[model samples]
Target: GPPRGRELEVARLVRQLARERIHNVVFTAADVHYAAAHYYDPTRAQFRDFEPFWEFVAGPIHAGTSAPLPMDNTFGPQVVFSKGAPPGQTLSPLAGLQFFGQLDVDSRSRTLTVQLKDASGQAIYRHTLQARRA
Candidate 1:
């Protein structure tokens, strides 16, 4: 999670991007010791001046796994998918809670595909996004 005031900064940036007509902006992050997919939509956000976007989170390929944290609603983020240890529990890497993510971009179609995989390299969740034309 970001420190205090960071979300406001992000909201400001989002509004600026919308003013510039930027679209299909995606964000990826790790280090939460879990895997999840979130979708942010201005229509459902507290700050509603930006377009919808996607944020992918994954990590801890070889470390202990922590439970998913509560999401902030400043950006109106909805959890599309999430996998993590049970509440109040931590799983070691050997417990098979490890995960990794893959992203593929196609220039011809201007699309982005995101996949979250387990230790065995099997995809557990997948999503594809078609870029908006400028």
Candidate 2:
């Protein structure tokens, strides 16, 4: 998770981008000991001046797995998908809870695909984004 002040600063930047008509903004993060996908909708945020965007989180490829954490509400993140250890339990890497993410961009079609894969390289979750026309 990010510091609250920094998150707010990012929110302001996103608001500025929205005012400039920017679109198709996406964010990625890792090292939270879990894998999850989040969608941020300005309409649902405490700060409502930004456009919608997607965030993909993945990590702990060889560490203990942790359950998903609560997202800050300033940007209104909705957890669209998540996979991790159960509550009050931390699974070791050998437990098959390890994960990594893959991203593929298709320049011709202006699309991006994201996949969260397990230690054995099998995708457990996938999502595709179609770039918005300028």
Position 118, candidate 2: lDDT:
86
How many clashes would you count in candidate 1? 0
What local distance difference test score does each model get? 0.88, 0.87
Cα lDDT of model 1 by residue, 1-134, tens digit: 33247676887888898999998899998869999999997777777888888989888868999899887777889999999999989998988989999999999989999999998999999999999987
Model 1, C-alpha of 43: deviation from truth (Å): 1.4
lDDT of 2 at 95: 88
lDDT (tens digit, per residue) of candidate 2 on 1-134: 33276676886788798999998888888859999999998777887888899989888867899898777778888999999999878988888898899999999999999998988999999999999998
Q: Could you tell me which 10 consecutive residues in candidate 1 have the lowest summed lDDT?
A: 1-10
* Local lDDT at 50 for model 1: 86
